[model samples]
Target chain A: MTTASAEKTAENGAGEEGYNFAYLDEQTKRMIRRCILKAVAVPGYQVPFGGREMPLPYGWGTGGMQVTASIIGHDDTLKVIDQGADDTTNAVNIRRFFARTAAVDTTEVTAEASIVQTRHRVPEDPMTEGQILVYQVPQPEPLRKLEPREIECRKMHAYKEYGLMQVSLYEDIARFGEIATSYSYPVMVNDRYLMSPTPIPKFDNPKMHDFPALQLFGAGREKRIYAIPPFTKVKSLDFDDHPFEVQQWEENCALCGAEDTFLDEVILDDRGGKMYVCSDSHYCARRRAEGHRGTLSDSAAAAYAAAVGAADRPSEDGESAEWVT
Target chain B: MAAMATLAGSAPGGIDTTDLKPGLADPVHDSQRVFRALLEAMARPGRPLQLEEGLDPPFPLDPATAAAVLTLCDHDTPLWIDWIADTPPVRAYFSFHCGCPLVERSQQAAFGLVSDAENMPRLGLFAQGLDKYPDRSATLVLQVPSLSEGLAVQLSGPGIDGRETLRAAGLPDWFWNDWRLNAAQFPLGVDIIMTSGRALVGLPRSIAAEG
Candidate 1:
């Protein structure tokens, strides 16, 4: 074939053979970058842009991936997590995707990553300066639940008319004796606009306040991006009498004995046997490596140990290789 | 061939275009650095950020403004240049390098360049963007004499913890009055970037500016 035909064929087969650097063209990146700058300029204000459809589905972290792609360089280390576990299927898929497309290093450790894309949880570890946390948002507007009309929500945000949100919270209190918003709790950004902190549980809401790392939220389906610069104030919406509170658990992690971390309840069988473990897999594993034993029975601990050992094995393709325990 | 050579040889006013300078040497990396600096400047309003200096645009264009224009503007962005910078050579340079169309009306521009801040178009002249998407508003990049040697103005808003004092010269006395009117609109106002030498300070619409 001639050189021209070969180039045409390559262009035709771009997706299967090779993707653009980080899977986004430079023009698209520039557009998103402009939106990001504006979002940073006006904290908690959602800046709309032309959100591109990624190779993955819309609900599957396409937003976070795009933000990561725009900001990531060849030298950056990326980490992806779903519900705070690095070994989940979605996290592994995203990690593998970036590994192939961008050729950047991937890590499971929270502190080692320069960029962390998360779906529903912020890592328990404190992020240092220069690190960026990208959250995949399903809904960018905090008032969407109350007002379905986009125009009305815009006006409400414009005139600082947040009475509907307060009424909703008051109604929740009247019904359940507490604010019923467990995840995706609304928070005020820089004391200006009310923002939804994605779907992270209320337990992680405190981490968004005065955070050292810059936080960027992208909603691909909604075609919006917003930001909270480092050290910006974020206050969860609440009344003085009914202050904000996180979920409290009576049991520590069954595997790592970490009482401070967010815990996930796991059922052993059809019987009444149950256990609580850290939702963050890396945090649990690091504690286990540090020889922090928990309340797991002997056989359960041994079985968990074997599973972790298998997960640490080296593989031929490094993309699917076991995550660091 | 003669016509083509003439078109390329010199712009209007007999300014030779043979030795035209380059924009950021490495477009991708350099633009990323510039964007980072711009992001910081916008996030922390009233704080001066020193930008990397390499661009060599013609006279009347400050280094910071030029760097910002080159980094942010593309064919997609419509640019509006003030009277002082609406020259043929500068227009040719922008059209050739950035590919952004020069607009006559400030309201239509995605980015506006002001060479003379004292005579700049009124804040109401530019697009304040729609209420739904206020980010669509134009970002005004004003070239000033110096950032540190101006009248001290107090700014208080989202980025500022309490209030910040900044010295920005080269603006009309009525600018602060206009800014107050602009801030009253909240989510709907033109954001300003003051450039002097290689430094820039952002004044986002959320800020309350008072002398």
Candidate 2:
């Protein structure tokens, strides 16, 4: 058998033989679990942890992977999303990695997933209770860029001194006539710690507030983990007069004609060609399956057939592990 | 050779008759499930979840408490226990399953167990942690009578939506006031996990409640 064939995972069989369950040792998982419990206890407060080296690099969702590995059980259904697209290489690779290592069933449907590990964007679908959302955070501190010192940041957090973050927002409003931060927007968690919502676009910030699902953030490189419990208040920083506003697009999705979801601008070609599509590819596919179509799509019937077809779950036939969506 | 050939699963007079009977049936998967339940309980403060089932602990020990101890505790964690949980059987169970050091003083403990809620120590007695490292505080596994029925208190804070009703029974009258003082400490207080037979509710420092 070829190396590639040996690597292919068809179902929830025993994963790679050498590695422990979920690729993390029992001791490491315990330590990370301790950090996780602490993170959940103090909502949005970055709890320092002893970071471990992963198979992948630091920034490429290692932190989120660590959290997912620690919390994932045998019965869990895993989902991985990079920028909300399930078909992306990073998303597919991570999904494959977990499928092979942990021997857990993986899916692309946002609602069906028990643990959704994501980078850059939250799923467009509403996350209900019992669903755990793990975010890949580059930096856990919201005040890091302003105050580089760790001790000062901890002191500020201890004393409830969040004026520096507010001042920075004020500076943005003064220059751009609004809070200019498009992604990784600063949010006050439970009206306490100012938290970085993991580089997700500002449009997804409101979804964090009063969300029914537990949200966990992990910064592997920074050796920190934080969390926002379900039903918690996560408010984006803005003035009363200015108010916090999400980015709005006049263009609909180029593939599924979604007018409400966060749109991603796609470059069609070199000759000044571009089209706006839903950043959440899973939601876009669902829309297409429900008969929504755009100018780029072939037809509504074709889109439906392409979406809710045999390709959506290819592992049932025992062939390719590439994500269809 | 005589001591070595004694027995496999239990001591001469161990509470747990079998070694495997002390902890979860399956450590890897069971810990995951228990922790998931615990994560949910922590995320939603007022709501009580059926944490674990079918656990036979020593006298006065709740199954939910045993489940948490088995899943979360290790040699690194120092656990402080009250008289109810300080019995010989209970100590043997912890030694066999958890192996966590049982500390006499609450302040030195990273975790605490209070089977006697009425006589539980003051919230300040447990480690409140340092100002800079508030997460270093202790997490008390407080065994209560019933999480479903009790004094209907209002809980509003980080984890709560607008306002939530928590009905915890058998708690002292000074429970709410003591919790209030604890909350006033803000990033420096011990978190509580109230447990009954098979149910538990997490009361993290982020919550503020009044009866």
Candidate 3:
């Protein structure tokens, strides 16, 4: 995923052949910047901004792109990931979009990237102080599901009234004997605003607390921007008896042979065979290159590589040509 | 530079506007850099970032504050300049470069600049925003003497890791006392950005300051 960074800033006029640098006009960037400041000023508090339409659709990391476009500079190294894999279509297209539009350096190695735009997963790597992590949020409001009314929700946030949210959590505990929420876990930022963690698994919630990197969340369709500045307290909302716990797996990552990382279960065949591989593709690859091998890694490595490669290029003839003939 | 329209007597309140200066050399990339600095400063409250934009904005505005004003403010944001900063040249400079409406009252401003921090208006005078809409408050940009040479205070809050010290001189005797009252408002208070020379430190509403 780490493409050899080429020097192309001078040739592209800060963007591709025609578009403005980073694809956003100066004024729009200014507007977004000001909102970002406000969001930082009040951590975890969502600040509404006049969100602009991006070339991509609303759900496909458009909010993250807008935030990236606003803050990205010529010298910054950009990296995009969908569910922690840089090779996925959403990640690939977005990385290419910035490479062409923003004319910024691109990398896949988490440490090398200055501004990382992510969806569904925060990188396993610990980001440094100056690095920025931009999250694409589908819903900026944490209480929207409970209250539904925007005005009522606003009032609740104003007064720090979160009894409804706590009641919903209690209901989850009563039904499942434990809190059943696996993702999009609610958190109390700075012990003030209850914020939605944007569907990132509860496993990543602890990483946000006192993390050195600045975390920014943008919800394009919702027209809201929020932030969690570096070193802020992000506590998972939970009772003492029913403590917040992240999902744990009995199996380690089959690809990386690691006991800690999150694993994605892949069905091997129709005969009930399954393999648990690292959800973070780059991390798994790095581990494999360091001579770490799982139970089936030696046998399945070529097949997995071929499958990912096949997904990269479409059938050139047509969809019918692959199956019809 | 955009066409310098020196509207001598056309400025509000009958201020001469002939002497003006350019905002930024490169509006697009320059502002992005400036905004990143501003964002970083806001995130790490006591930390100062180097913001030498090579700008010479009118009599009152320094490079850091000017960079912030030029990058953040627009026609949509109503701006206010305190008496010390509300000079004819300052008015002319903002009018030509920023085009932000300069409101007479501090409460009406989304952004404010205070040249004389020691004698500036009280914290309550500016927009404290609303309960529902806290981000609608005013962001005051002040030119202080130095970030390290002044009254040192311990800051611990959202942005600070544990405890960071903030030092700046020339603020009024009532500054910290007023700040405490302002912080009592929680999500409904003004944010301050102090600039000295080419450096700046952001004092957002969330920071808890102690001497």
Residue A176, candidate 2: alpha-carbon lDDT:
85
lDDT top scorer: 3
Residue A70 lDDT (model 2):
93
Evaluated on chain B only, what is the TM-score of candidate 1? 0.91
Order the candidate numbers by TM-score, best to worst: 3, 2, 1
Give model 1's docking category.
acceptable
Q: TM-score for all predictions?
A: 0.86, 0.90, 0.94
lDDT of 3: 0.84
Local distance difference test, candidate 1:
0.82
lDDT tens digits, residue span B55-156, model 1: 778878987889999888889999999999998878877876677888999999999999899999899999998876778888999888888999999988
lDDT of 3 by residue, A40-59 (tens): 99998899988999988999
Q: State what share of the real interface contacts each candidate retains.
A: 0.34, 0.71, 0.91
Tens-digit lDDT track of model 2 for A47-144: 98878999989888889999999998767788888898776666767777787788777777788889999999999999988799999999888889
- Report the lDDT tens digits of candidate 1 across residue range A193-278: 99999999999999999887879999999999999877688999999999999999999999889989999887777899898989
List the candidate 3 regions with Cα displacement exceeding 4 Å.
Answer: A1-13, A310-325, B1-17
**Greater-DockQ candidate between 1 and 2:** 2
Model 1: residues with Cα > 4 Å off, grouped in runs: A1-19, A297-302, A305-318, A321-325, B1-19, B148-156, B160-177, B209-211
Backbone clash total for model 3 is 0
